[model samples]
Target: MRARNFVSVIAAVGAGVALVSGCGQGGASGSSGDSKVIKIGTLHPMTGSNAGDGAQLQHGAELAVKKINDAGGIKALGGAKLELDAGDTKGTPDTGQSEAQRLVSDGAVALVGSYQSAVSANIAAVAERNKVPFVMDISGDDAILSHGYRYSFRLQPQNSRFGATAAQYIKDITKSKGRPVTKIAYLHEATAFGTGVYTAFKSEAQKLGLAMGPEITYDAASVSDLTTQIAKVKASGANILVVSGYYRDGVLAAKAVQTVKPKLDAVIGAADGAFDQPQFPTDAGSAANGYFDVNYHLNDKSAEAKAFADLYQAAYHDKARASAGFAYDSVRIIAAALERAGSKDPGKIRDAIAKTDLNPLSLSNGPVTFDEKGENTAGLPVLTQIQDGAPSVVYPDNLAAKTIVYPAPVQ
Candidate 1:
């Protein structure tokens, strides 16, 4: 029941206090009566374009399971060991659905991950039908929780929250720089994740009375070059460009800026997508230097969050990813739920997850609590700029790693 991790929740792991209240030793699962093992399935992309992200998320869950088992597993379940049942989504919806079935068939009482919004939706459906408890690590599309399912819970903020937060960040950034962001341009992928963020942001922009310009939506998969889309952004004469998409598309968008070379003050983002991933700087080179992305990130200022960032970076041999922490926390949360429920029955696990309220050791955010819709009520997003190649937290004042670099010199 230790609350620790970063995107799939991202950060390094460090020292933290013992977590969660446990029910005295009891049988966690009917199957565990003999094997004394509680299985949790980790569903995420292990192949395809988002494979790198999936791999990171998978490792996060692996580390959590290791940490839990190393500490004597679930004490309430007669010290039953936690077993991770890993499944590959292959970064596709159909594959994701199939994988969920595979995991459930293998006797997983709980599940975590599958990063894409679309894929997560598919897995969520399977988990719901099978009556398995699902903890979604990272898939921000708002509709995931709108279906009124009782079994699935999200550990991150909804996509709509990202839009409103980004709009407010834009206003603050412009005001600090003494140049008001008047006209705004919108660019996003056509997928649910992309379109959902943009739709919410557009509504927020309208409320702010900002003049809207060209809004371009394109497929992130086939659209390698964004000249056709950037052309519209350029012609719109907007000082700010708000983009939504994943890493590959974000790189294309940044390159498009180089190709079209718009005289833009800033190109902010709704999703970490391209900017927050480690490969972004290496992929985009100098172009990623000035780009700022707004997404959920670790508030490393807290001792617990700092501990997690260190642990994740050291264990993975790479800096913590934007989504790693949540994934890690999700697994731990499920494990804690198992301890609280004292039963492996899916319904009991789901009930325990609903009452979870431990402070996450992964990020310096709010306590881990769920609303009626199965969304984390404490989830908060962060703004980051690619400062010298790595994402540096720079917003919300209290958790900032560095100050915002207004008008980052065009590379």
Candidate 2:
């Protein structure tokens, strides 16, 4: 039987406790050119806490698969069409493992996903044990790549890189424009992703001689109000505010800023996917204005990135922010490896991935190359400011499509 024909049980990602199922659909439609199908699994938080992030990643992967198939499928595998065998991790480690087995049993040669850092770690372990190539989309925790797992690879800049980038970007902005950003406050969720970024940011900030104001941590999903956190940050006389959290946190943070009207000069987020969400500006209203999200993202100025953004916006009615772009690139990276290997063997695919050197023109970070640690060396963070109700690249001059809104007018 063709690998694509194998259908496995899909978790009821939304409900979390139900045993639901579906067929392997590459968004599944019959294409005349390729009779053979290559199934790629996306194990992500399709439901539960990080559901929004999971759905965005899933759509990005789907879009990539569709684009490949539309372009006459993979020529190396007898014009084999790509198929998606997605599993929802439901925001849990146990479900991530079970779903990993399900994806492999259902015939996935390679896997991509589980956006949450904790879930991604478990998925990475399963992929390693089974010897399947795993392409990561968006989990920034540093430990995910420290395991020495050969089968696991990441496309996004890891935690250390992200934190360092934030510090450097702040320094650069201050140096160039003389922006007074001496003391900064960090308010984040208490997750591996949040704390890891905070740790890295703190280290880098100290190295750059920046003062840390109040370091406030909260639960991204459970926390209802950040009023106290924002008040404390304000009281610390922090001119700059850094936040790390998910969608709800982003909204709450922005609302708190609006309510408290802190004498803040700037508010930056550390790849807190929520700020990149379409609903962020709407939910946060004018408060989202001038907020910058510093994380690895597609180079908006690149023609190729712009084109993909258009496609993604059309499909999802939302911007192809970093998370979506990360997902698309993860799938495309696997596809590129498959093409290079010119075979269906998982081992061959793994080798191709290890040797990957994607041209900067193809991705935002420019030159997608994985180091010995399975981290994309060229994957660096970009600075994006919420401008005119949408997020636009503002710093790292080359990748930025728009200029920074200095002295953020958060009126």
Candidate 3:
């Protein structure tokens, strides 16, 4: 009887140990069958105001997984195929945190996603707590990387960089067009994403001798009209109007500008979401013409990028946007890290990502590399303009697809 009791106690302890081990390393490195697949979690707002953008992000990651699996999967791990575990945040921070937790509990070795800055912040905290590596696909708030968290990596240029680049582009383009910037009206959404870009733009514009005023803000989720705000911009007598906001709100602002007819020398976007979108021209109608967005986009000149775009279009029957490119690259980055790590341990994967050095399929200042803060040191944004119903690069002569038309002709 004593021997049987001892045996039962030992069995219980072993079971508990197994349970703990399973939770720590996830299922990717488990049983022989499980080790044949790696699970990667992706969080995005698939059912909220930003659903369209979220869908693109998810699809990009999906396409990347397909490409890798088709090419014989991860070579280091015996060609283990990648399995994406997608979660919907519904554009809320709480949902994002919860979804991240669920994904980790379900055995995701790494994570990617979340377009909104606020949502990404919450997801980042979760990643740090769980010691999981998170590669942000589109979130741009600089503060997200300021937390000193080693597990969170951002693929997009910080908001501050985006703002400064936009300002510099504005200065160079206006001067070359013989319509040097003077007074500028600024409009942005009321959030870290929008406000962060605006603050940096204001500082850069000041240094460039560009007077700015009539700064306006709107609730991106609630605001329905921007006419009164744009009317204020027109009354300020500002020669240029600079906008910072997401896709839905961006389109609304564009229509409002068309209605108000501010007659400004130029209307440009500082990391504006809607302007660089493939459907922006059609969605904004004639208002999209002459609209310029200084933001990150796919490198159309790269043959690899061209092939990816073709694959995306052929698979989805729509052109892949800048957001999609980032998401696709995020997956590729993870796969590369997995190959280097030769293990499915989250910590090992995180370390491998820190040393990443691969040429991206998107526009960038250099190859993909992460800094001490997990920020992509080589991320870059370029100026894109809407001409004849399509978005084309038009600045920084090296990447320009078309000559810019400044002081845009009256519609």
TM-score of each: 0.88, 0.88, 0.91
> Residue 161 of candidate 2: its Cα lDDT?
79
Q: Identify the runs in model 3 with alpha carbons over 4 angstroms from their true place.
A: 1-33
Query: In model 2, which regions exceed 4 Å deviation?
Result: 1-35, 276-279, 360-365
Expressed as tens digits, the lDDT of each residue in 1-411 for candidate 3 is: 001121232243232111111111223334334778788988887776787788788778877877787788899999988877778888889999998998898888899989999999999999999999999999999999998999999999989998988888988988888887768899999889999999999999889988887789999878888999999998998889999998888999989999998878888999999998888988889988888999998888899899988876765666788898899999999999999999999999999999999888888889999999998999888999998799999988998999999887325
* Each prediction's number of clashing residue pairs: 39, 4, 0
lDDT of 2: 0.77
Clashes of 3: 0
lDDT of each: 0.78, 0.77, 0.85
- Candidate 2 residue-wise lDDT, 278-315, digit = tens: 56788789888888888766665578778877776665
Residue range with the least summed lDDT across 10 consecutive positions in model 1:
17-26
- Ten residues in a row with the worst lDDT in model 2? 1-10
User: Which candidate number has the best TM-score?
Assistant: 3
